[model samples]
Structure formats: C-alpha cells, structure tokens
Target: MNKVLISADHVITGPADRVITRGAVLVEGGSITAVGTAAELDTSVEPEVPRLACPGATLLPGLIDCHVHLAFDAGPDPLRAVAEADPGELATAMADRAEQMLAAGVTTVRDLGDRDALTVTLRDAIAAGTATGPRVLAATAPLTSHGGHCGFLGGEVTTDDEIRARIARNAEQGADLIKVMASGGALTPGGPRMWQPQFTRDQLRLIVDEAARYGLGVAAHAHGTDTIEHCVTAGVRTLEHCSWRTAEGIVYDPPTARRIVENDIAVCRCVSGDWRLFLEQMGPERAEAMAGVIRDMRKEGVRFIAGTDAGVPGARFGDYVGMLEFFSSLDFSHAEILDMATVHAAHALGLTDTGTIAPGMRADLIVVDGNPLESLDSLRAIRHVLTAGRPIGM
Candidate 1:
C-alpha cells in the first residue's frame, strides 16, 4: 500500500471553522488514514512513506462549485458556439474547462447545465481515470419552457407529460441531479423578460415531484420573485440566481426568504467574473440594486453556497478565487466564505466524502502559501493540490 504524509503549518479540519496547528494528514491509497499534529502521528507512520512539509502554508478541503456550465465555453458568444459544436467537439472543450477548474483547487463541481448530456460523459471519464479533472455531479440538461430561458439546449417541455418524460430521460442518462429553469434569463435575447416567471406553480411542482421519484434533487434557476416563491413551494433542493427581480425593481420578500430557510433549500448566488467588468455592464444603479437584494437575503438567514457560474460569458474557469471578493463585499468572514465553498457546498451537492479533512474521507485537499483565514487572497497562492490522494500537475 502506498502511503503519503503531508504536514502544514495549519490544517483546517472537518470544516473551515476548525483548525489544527502544525497538523499532518496521512493518506493510504485514496483515503485519509489519520489527521493530527505532526508530533502526534509522524513517528507512527512507516519510515518508508514519503513526506511533504510546508512550514508556512495552510491545508484545507478542496473547494466545491455548486453551480457551473461545463458545456458553455465562457466565450463572448457561448450559446452560438455551443449551438455550432457537435457532441464530440463539445466534450473536448469541456475536458479543457475541467482541467482549468482543477488547477484552481476546485476538486468537485456540480455542472448545472449542458447540451446532449455531454457532461455525463465527462463525469464518467473522470471517474474512470481517463481524464484529469474534478469529480463532477452533472445535470444532463435543464428543463425549460418553450422559448424560455436556455430553451435552445433542447430541454423544452410544456405539458405535464413532457415534463415527466424529460425528467425520466435525464434520470435514465445517469444524471446526478435535475435542473429546471423556472424564470426567464438575460442571456437569451427575445426570450421571456428576466423578471418573468417561466413555469406555472403546478408545472414547477411537477418537476420537483418527478425528480424526487428518480431520487434526484431539483435545482431551480429563479430570478423573478414569483419564480422564487414557486420554487420554494415546489420543494426544490437548491435555488440558483435567486436575485428576486421584479418589473419595477428588486424586491426583498421577507416571507419568501423565511420559507427558503424553513425548507433548508441551499441558494447559489452564481456571482463571478471580473467585478469591474460586471459593474460596468450592469451599471452602478442596477448593480447596487441587485447587491442590496442579496444583502437583504443574507440578513434573512438564507444559506449561501459559493459558485462562480464558470463557463458563462466573462466568468472564466480557474478564476474561482477572484470571485471570493463578492462574498467579502457582503461582509462575510473569511471562514464563513470558505465554508460556503467547501463544507456548505459539499453538503448542498450531496457529496459526503470530498469536502472535509477527516479520517476515512477522500483525500481531496489544497495547500496554500499563507493563512487564508487571515487573508482571502492567500487562496490564490496555491502551492499544492491533491485530488483523491493524487497530486494535480500544475
């Protein structure tokens, strides 16, 4: 059995909230065997085992992205590009995107959208050791209304029968979860308005029920206030882009926020890309309006998971650390933000063994040069990354 020992100045164990100084982790095969201070276990390991020591670094669980679109190329015209590419071509691009994400210490990612169910192919390849990338939990194709948000992906379902059939097809394809576009989006021109609800309450409930029958959780993409409320009532597991937009302006519905908390539904704000560019595109007034709504949601005790929405236009893969500024801007502590990217995100994705550093857990971790708890910027200083006890060649 191959064994490796890694010791760091500080080890964040269990969750981002816990830390052990001068800590060491022992890995045998692909699982963690022991985690404790170097002085406690260094002498007990086999003398022939290899050891890596970083005196001024911190080790923590590998990051998890709850929302992403691996099929989109993050190009200026991702939709056009996706529409033009065949499945084989799209899979190649997705593999490159996956490698980029792994380089940035994101060892696990939940792909919320894809075309042709290609993400499932990539997910299987990674699991079979034929690819070098994060462990993927992919939603084959997102359900959308006719000409609604992302309807071009070919998952448009109108009637209850269509919805059930689509859900069954995705489950047959080995989807890890189900994604439903419950509201209109800004990405599709001439589609429903961004503040418009795409699906009726009954349709949304049908999606939730059908997905539950397949033992798959539903992730609802909701921006409008009505859509958000519908998703909550439908009992979806997670809400993506819950911006609470309206025709007049952003609204902070306290009752809906409380309902989300009561249901324990995870929310992925999907904030990413260059902040400066985002501000310029959104304009100061619109940006501030959206930010205010998000701030209010945080105040209402909504649970947040960090997701970059990578592969979207301007939201490049491998830039996950840069997106941390958004949470910091909301006055989230470093530990809290890290939790959103790690433990909280893992739980949201239903990953049991990949998010925390503990005995018998998968050895997915990253070592940075400085203390991330003190400075979030340290996360960018990635000295090493291990996925399933194997080093990522950066």
Candidate 2:
C-alpha cells in the first residue's frame, strides 16, 4: 500500500541539506518512495493508505539519542537506585521511559548501559510490536575495569581472558555493540578520579580486537585524558563523555583530538544542561578545567555527537533539547546541533537506514509544530511521530 503524508510546513531532510516546503512524503511498505511539495504529487489514483496532515509542522528523520542508561533512574543517587530496584521494577520503569521518549519524538535510542541485559529484551519487544517505543540499539552490558566506572552491571574485567569472555557473552546474547568503561566517572562513589585511566593500553587493545572479531563496535565511556588516549590507540569506534580532565587541571590532548578527527571515531558529548548542578557540587574550579578541555577539543575539529546520558541525575529520556541547547552554547549552529542528534548520531550507532528523510529510506520520521531551522525549541512541539511507517500516538 502506498501512503502519502502531507507535512505541516517544511520538511528537513537532514545532513544532505534538502528541504521541501509545503511538502508531502510518500511511503511504500516501510520505505519512503518520494519527497516533494504537496502540489508536485498527483495522488488521486494511488492506493492511498492514509494521510497525516500536519499543516503547521516540519517533518524530519527520527531523532537518535546516542547514549542512555535504561537501568539507571534519574534520582539523586542513581547508582544506589539501580542497586535497590528489583529487576521487575527496573524493567517496568525502563519500558515507561521508552514510551515517553517516543511520544516526545525520539524514534531511535542507543542504550549504552543497563543491568541484567534488560535493554536487549526491551529491544526485542519493541521490534515484535509488543511494546510502544523507539527503535533501540542495546548494549547488553558495559564492560568496565575491575571496580571502575559503572562496574555494578557485572562487567568488570581484570584480564585479557575476562575481556574476551565478556565480548563473547554479549555477542552470543545478540548485542548491538560492546560498551567499555575506559575511564573513571563522577557518578561512581569513591571511584577513581574521572581523569584516571581504567584500562591499560594492552587491556583496551584486547577488548577492541576481540569485539572486532565478532563484528561488534565498541563504545567507550571515557572522561579522562589518559583513557581517551588508550581508546584511540585501541581503535575504538565511538567515545562517550570525552570530557578530558585531570586531577590537577584541564588536560586536553591535541594529538588525541587530531586522531579522533582523522579516524572519524564518533564522540558523544553526553553533556546535559544539568551539568551546572554537578559542577556546583564538585566546585567551580574543576568545572572550569573540564570546560576548557571540551572547548579545546571542539576547536580541534573533533567529530562530536549528541547524547544526554539520560537516566542519570537530571538527564531524562525525551529531554534531548537540553543537549542541543548545551551545544548551542558551545558555538554549534542550529543545523549542526540537529545533525549531531540525527544523522551523526545514527551513523555513530550504525543505523544508516533511519537517520534521514530521503528516497528509499526507512520511514522513521517526526513532525514538529514549528520550524526547527529557526530555533531548536521547535522540537519540543512535536505534532506526530512515525516509526517504519507506523503512526505512534501519545
């Protein structure tokens, strides 16, 4: 069946810089067959599956969130919350959050960490149509150095053999990608300083090599300078929270920044607007140091992507506008910020089929009530959203 959707106003086609005003998008099966002005198409004789007319909205490819933790609750103490919650309770909460994200116009999300592989199960349920939510890329477990950041998910590795075993286990469970905690983190109580390296170069090399053997990409949670160096050396495909700070002060690595640009390894900022609160708690000096490093990295031509680390503290699913606003503060254009959330993020997560609105693309799209081109705030007024040609209603 062929269906035509006449969008409200403009249709932003994504990184390709294509737009159709007073646009209409035609879908056949699960793929888009045409995109043009409504007046350009003669749809009278077609099968006419249905039309979702949004007279005041702009349609674009589904938004992609490259980082999230389905297992963690956005509580004052998320790590403690995860430990206290039972598996059943966590599953129910995660499912609810997924639906909230879809309702808010996020059609795809990459779950970077979860306890007990719940995300994998949730992904299957969404695909089977048993759940109402966004498409998911599940990282069964995030590999961590023994007692390193987020080590509670049972992915602490002390040796190369342990690393290999973990990757094998995730691949066997049908993981979309292998996530490695390469550095210390601020959220882990009494964890190593955020700038400290969690894994040795050889250790990282082993993880990357093993994951490559299974055709799985590695998403490393790295905040420290030394750890980011190890990640680049190990040839990691994606880096999360590349904050680049040391105990002493700002420690931006120019060579590592250049390598990231040259290698095209995607970097997820995962910086939520709530970072201000965390900064205040940690003190102004440390925040300033880290901000300096981030600014320098951006200036060094790093390939940055958007991720709110939602589910942690103040970051929540469907609150991605906070991320875009943060990027805007960093001097990224509105178009660049949207690209980081859409095409760049999709490419980072290996979802090439659903990032853009174009011919032969998967019909995963969202409509907003205003022009996102004019301002990022337009995303908040989502009129409708569709995943694979299936309309989803709140």
Candidate 3:
C-alpha cells in the first residue's frame, strides 16, 4: 500500500462552508485516512511516508462538471466534425480532451453525449489505468426524437419498443446514466426550434421508467418551457440547460420552478466560459431576458450546479474555472459557487466517495496558490492535483 501526506495552508472540507487552517490529509491505498490540522496529524503518520508541504496554498476537493461532451472538439462545427471522424479518430480526440480536463483540475465529469459510444471506452480506460483523465460517468449516446436535437449522434428513437431497446443497449455498453433530449437545440441546424418540445410526456415517462429499472438516473436536456414542464412531470432526476425558452421570449414558469424545487431535481445551467462572447452573440435584450430568468430561478430556490457545456462552440474543456465566473456574475457567494462545483455537483452525479476531503473519501484533491473562497480566480492557479491518490504529472 502506498501512503502520502499532503499539508497546505488551508483545507476546505466536506461541505463548501467548512475550512481547516494549517491542514493536512493522509492518503493510504487511494483513500483518505485522515483530515485535520497539520499540527494534529504531524505525529500520527509514519516518518518514512512521503510528505508534500505547501505553505501558502489552499487544498480543495477536485471539481466536478455535471455536463460535458468529451467527443466534441469545441470547434465551430462540432457536429460536422463528429460526422466526418471515424470511431478511432473520435476516441483519440476524446482521450486528449480528457487529459486537458484533468490538467484543469476537473477530476470528475459526466459526459452527456458522444459518438459511437466512445465516451464509455474512455471511461473504462481511465478506470483501468490505461488512460489518464478524470473519473467519467458516461451517457454513451443521448436519446433523441427522430430528426430532433443531437439526432446525428445515432440515438434517435421514435417508438416505445425502440426507446426501451436503446436504453438497454446503453446500459449494456456500461453507461453510468441516461441522457434524453427533451427539446430542440441551437447546435442542430434545421432541426426543431430551440423552444419546441421533442418528446411527448408519455415518451419521457417511458424513458424514465426504463432507465429506473436499470438503476440509472435520467438527465433531461430541456430548454423550452413546455419541455421543462414535461421533464419535471415525467420524474427526470436532473434538468440540463433549463433555460425556460418560449417562442415569444424567455419565460419563468413559477409552477414548474416550484415543482423542480419541491422534488429536489437538480438543474445544470451550462454557461459558456466565453460568456462575454455569448452575450455579444445573443445581444443585450436576449441576454438580459435570460439573466432575468436565472435570477428568478435563484429566488425560487432552485438547486443549481455548475457545468460549462464544454465541447460546444465557444465552450472549451479546461475552462471550468472561467465558467465559475458566470455564477459569480449572478451575485452568488463564493462559497455557494464552490458548492455548486463540488458538493452539489457530486450529489447530482450520484458520486458519493470523491467530492470532499474527509476520512473514508477518495483522495481526489487540488491545490491552488490562493484562497478560492475569497477570489474564484485563485482556482485557475492550479499547483497540484491528485486523483484517487495518484498524482497527475503537471
């Protein structure tokens, strides 16, 4: 068994609200053995064990991205690229993308979409130590209506039997969860408009039922108001985007928002890292409308998790820290923002062992040069990262 002790100036542990100054964590066999003030742990470990001491840094649980697509290259036309690349080429690109995510201190990611079930292959490779990357909960391919959003990824299913069969295929392929496209999207040109509903209420319910039989949670990609209502009524576990878009404009349905809060369904609002560019593209009127909707949701006490929607145009992997700034812009406290990336995100993804620094937890941690509680920009200055007690070469 390998053992290592890491000491830092401050340690943020468990919930984002708690911190320990002059803290140290002991790792044994890829699990945290202890977490306490450095003085308290100084004499408890073996003298021969390796120790890493950083005098002015903060240690935190590795960040989690609730939604990402490892297969897309963040190019202007990721859909086109996916269509052109063979399976091998897509897998190689995904491997490289995963490394970039690890380097950025994203230690866990939920890949919500991919081609040829490539994300599952990368997920397994990373688990077996054959590849270097974050712990991945891969969806393989997302279920979409025929010719609906993201239909080109080959997850288009129309009938009830087809839906159940597709769900079974993904489960057999080792998918950690299921992703369903509940509405249209901007990425798929000439598809259903962004505010248009794709899956019927019955269809969504069937998907949730089938996924539940396999003990897999269903995450719905919902941007339209009608679609969000459908997903909430269908018992989906998580709602991605949740933009509340209508053909007239952005609208916040209080009843739907209340239902989401009451049911404890998590909402992943994937703000682009280049938000300023996004605002410019969206123009002032539309951006303000969207921000207003988010503000209303926050006021309604909806649970929000941080996700960059990485792999989309203008949203790159390794930009999770930049994406945090979007939450900050919404006037969220730094602690609340950190919780979204760590504790809340972990709960959303059903990852119980790796979200926080504590005894019995997986030793997935990151050290930064400054205090993220005071300034989120500090997170970008990553000094070191450990995933499952294994140091990632920076």
- Index of the highest-TM-score prediction: 3
Error of 2 at 72 (Å): 1.0
Q: What value does the lDDT take at residue 174 in candidate 2?
A: 82
lDDT of each: 0.89, 0.83, 0.91
Residue-level lDDT of model 2, residues 328-353, one tens digit each, is 76677888888888888888787779
Better of 1 and 2 by TM-score: 1
Can you give the TM-score per candidate against the true fold?
0.98, 0.95, 0.98
Runs of candidate 2 exceeding 4 Å displacement: 42-49, 279-289
Model 3 misplaced regions, further than 4 Å: none
* Sliding window of 10 residues with minimal summed lDDT for model 3: 385-394
Question: Per-residue lDDT tens digits of candidate 3, residues 1-394?
Answer: 9898889999999587899999999989888999999988889888899889988899999999999999898999999999999888889989999999999999999999987788988998998989999999999889998988899898999999999999999999898999999999988988899889988999999999999999999999999999999999999989999999899988889999999999989999998789988988899998888889889999999999889999989899999988899889879899999999999899888888988888999989999998999999999999998889888983
TM-score of 2: 0.95
The total of clashing pairs for model 2 equals: 2
